[model samples]
Target chain A: MTLASALIRAHIRERLAAALALPIVALAASSIAMAGEPVTIRIDNFTFGPETVTVAPGTKVIWINGDDIPHTVVSQTKLFRSKALDTDDRYTFTFDAPGEYPYFCSLHPHMTGKVVVKAPAG
Target chain B: MHDPTDPNDDPTRPSRRGALECMVWAGTGLLWTLGGGLPRAVGLERALAAEASPAPFSFLQISDSHVGFNKPANPDALGTLREAVEKIRTLPQKPSFIIHTGDISHLSKDREFDDADQILRETGVPMFYVPGEHDLLDDEPGRAYLDRYGKGSRGAGWYSFDQNGVHFIGLVNVVDLKAGGLGNLGAEQLDWLEKDIAGLSSSKPIVVFAHIPLWTVYPEWGWGTQDGARALALLKRFGSVTVLNGHIHQIIQKVEGTIAFHTARSTAFPQPAPGSAPSPGPMKVPAGELRQHLGIASVSLVHGNEPLAVIDTPLAG
Candidate 1:
């Protein structure tokens, strides 16, 4: 084979490798974006378990009241508020904005929790 | 200062000292008698066990409505509260009024208060209220309760009013909630309570009502008031002092000197006896038996009665 022909073939091979790497990189990025899942905060014994939680924006946050007494999930900034939740009751709020939502049990002010929402990767 | 009638020691046996002390304070002190349209009463007996009462006025006590509560312990709390009202309406003799110990609502929401009012108002009797831990919730500390019932009340919703012949003082002890523990009646309220009662004659009958138990029912669940002893101290001089409370959601009675302490049952649900459950909360009972454990308290005061006649009749009966 001629040396010029050999160089051209090598160039073509390099181009093929580059094309293959682009999709693989794209898939990795997509997977990372898919990692966002629902988060939950447990209310038991007059406290918010996992007092702080961080999640991607649009992630649903759920509060389950395991304590015998009734409780409420109310946001400090009026972002979200749940009705009085009795034992084993559940309240869900999907945080869409990228910011912090500090919450507490309206029935018990000392019981507090926070959810940190992060922007999703493109 | 020795109070055997305090039934806090033993309801089955009324101590001789307590009976004698009661007779001394209640019996020859004054000839005044309570008047109302009630049945006849027999002469006084040594033990307060006899139903006979010196004063003819009767008042009802209801507590812990938890109107917003929708738990398994008692899903139909409002219905049960209505039932309690119905029971009160059917009494052979109408009670003068009702004094709620506390916990009118679970979440202290505006609708919760409205719901409770609708049910309680049906009984056709006025009700004096005190705040509970659940009533002074986050976002707004006591605004809902105070807006609805704070008129004529002192700081934090504590107030005193005069009935037919008795003085009723409502104390608020839930402004600051402890973490799953005991309640606190701040010094400010204590001082106000002191001055409020300072002018009353020692012979005048005093009836005090607060949400939490004035006595130490159990410290683990914050069942008792932190400064209840201080409030009770000032009330000791009165001839007939009845201190009734309702946070515990169960019936427990005691007597110390001239002061008689009683905790009434909740209209919404029942809590485990002190230390019976892992913690104090809504105690789930078997089906069809919840009403058996919940009821209102009726206090009978005769002008010179010692150890006011307290009757706890269940909603079912």
Candidate 2:
């Protein structure tokens, strides 16, 4: 093969590799989006299950009351609050910022939990 | 009126051991009567005789009527409450009025409150109430309770009423509870309490009732109030002070100087004593033994220097 032909082959190979990398990057982006899928914290027996939850930023968190009694979800700093949740009732909140948010049930204050939102990986 | 037995004479300083010992004795069939600031445990026969006798004016106290609770502890809460009211109706001497300490409803739902109201009204006795945490679980947080029972009450439904020369103060301490803390009366309610009894003479008999125990019974289960001490301090100057409460679902009485503290049992169900269970909730007894744990309280005020006589009558024991 001549130098011209070899140069063309190299360019084609480089272009092919770049094209293959595009789908891999796209798959990674889709997975990152999936990372924000909703998380659940169950309220049962006057307790918050899993007590503490860690999720990525922008992830949505849901609290479902499983006890026969009513409960409430109120943030420590008054950032978010849910009305009294009867049995099987649900409340949803999204953590958009990377920080620690602690909350408790206003009705039964002993039931407490925390949410830790992690920064996205570089 | 100060109890010479209590050296400190501080109403706020209660002995937890004394409270616990009293609880154990409560399970027996004996009834308690407070005379001259001392709780005297009498036989069931003598207590019945005392109840048959007359006094200046007697009132009934029914607490924790969780009308909507359908748990295994007691499947028919409303039915049991009706039974309690039935007992009230059949009393030899009808109560002048009824003082319901709190937890009138289970979930604070409209139907729960309605059911409780319907059953309690059957006795045809005027009722006074303080809100429990369960009664304030509505979406608006205590709006349902206040709307129905807050007529003349101030700031979360705390109010005072003069009944037969006794100054009755109904306090609200279940609102604005702090996280990981017990019940709270808040600064606003505390200020209101101070002024509510400011003009009353020290000799005037004061009866303070609230849902949660104003003194620390057990903090692990959130049975006590965080700012309850502040309110008790305000009442320390008064000679004849009787603090009645419910939420523990059992009888635990204490006497410190001129003040006497007592917690009434629930009309619906019973709860494990302080730390007996993993947590605090409806505790189920064996079959045919549930009534033994549920009951009502009757208090009699004799016109004189004699302290009020509080009688706790279980549904069955």
Candidate 3:
């Protein structure tokens, strides 16, 4: 092959390789998206804003108490306990297991909320 | 009026006068001891304490029990809550009613609610409740809480009633909470509160109860109500206003004008003070003092010509 043709052939091969890598990169990005970032729940007054949260396993659930009073981010199934958060306090716990974690304010037994952890789809 | 020369007055001139003076002195001493000094002896500091004993009308304020919680601090919160009820049952004076400031169930689950109900019902005291953020975890705000305890309340379990010359208001502030926001008493509730207290005379005492603190105890952990000022303003006209809350799980008291805000301790577990820990969570104490740190608040009402004295006694056991 002539030098010019050989160079073109090499360039095409490189382009093909790059094209093949795009799918792999896209797949990785999508998986990361599915895994989701940490979910932040702001606890104030007597209820959790964004009462129902959807996240994936390995996602960290951060509960921030912004009320002037203290509160708790307690899981229904005994999954985790953020003892009692005072004003501007925060508690973060990762959900490695996939399931619905319901919680309530320990101070006010009537106050309740939940977090749902989804598993990674195959 | 008898002559001094008579046997009654002449022989011992000081006899009758001295005897009468002595009798008068003894009478005065008896009055001071039995009538005036008895109240003081019993440690009655305020003038109103002399009126009458608080006719045994008491109510329970159980806060931050954090049911549905499992941790080293309190492995079985529901179990401990049952213990608290047992303690209440053994009280010399059983409270006529119970008020849960918030956090009735940890997870807002049917089972959690069921467990809390089973445990709480053991007390046999009529219970009233306000929602905590955890109680509003469902898709709808306070759906489970309202389903169980929000009867006769307005939207989201905010309501009011009259008992023993006091106006009691239960407010819901956890709904529509802002980002990085403290507790919120939305406009609707604010209007309602204003109207609720509008008709009451200034002499009438008002008790406003909620799950979040109406005053700023700590802002970082959302300890104060976002629009509590508005609520206080409505209560300004009242002679005595007591704002009771439970989300803090600790005892913090503040008085503003006619208003007094008190945050009660959690029966479930104790948390560190604001900024004490990196974040707010259960603080494990020695097993012995756990119950002491966490207990119920007893508010006794004695209706008389004076302001109601709310004496808060933490659970000793």
> Candidates' lDDT values, in order?
0.74, 0.82, 0.69
Clashes of each: 10, 0, 59
Q: Which prediction has the highest DockQ against the true structure?
A: 2
- Residue B181, candidate 2: C-alpha displacement in angstroms: 1.7
* Interface C-alpha root-mean-square deviation, candidates in order: 4.9, 1.6, 10.4
**Candidate 3 chain B lDDT trough over 10 residues, lowest sum:** B22-31
Chain B superposition TM-score per model:
0.81, 0.88, 0.80
Question: Per-residue lDDT for B1-317 in model 3, tens only?
Answer: 44655553443343322221111000001111122112111222332234244343557688777787776777778877887788788866677788888888775778888888888888898888898877766545567788888778987889999875567899987776654457888998998888877887665667789988988787876678889888887778765677889877777665565566767788788878987875456778898777767777766554332222334344554
Which candidate's TM-score is highest?
2
lDDT of 2 by residue, B54-158 (tens): 554668788999888887889999988999999889977688899999999988889999889998899999999999988988868889999999999999999
- For model 1 chain B, give the 10-residue run with minimal summed lDDT: B23-32
Error of 3 at B53 (Å): 3.6
User: Which candidate tops lDDT?
Assistant: 2
Per-residue CA lDDT of model 1 for B265-293, tens digit only, reads 88899989977876676789996888878
- Candidate 2's C-alpha runs over 4 A off are A1-34, A120-122, B1-28, B33-40, B50-52, B303-309
Ranking by DockQ: 2, 1, 3
For candidate 1, the per-residue lDDT at B288 reads 85
Docking class of 1: incorrect
Could you tell which candidate, 1 or 2, scores higher by DockQ?
Answer: 2
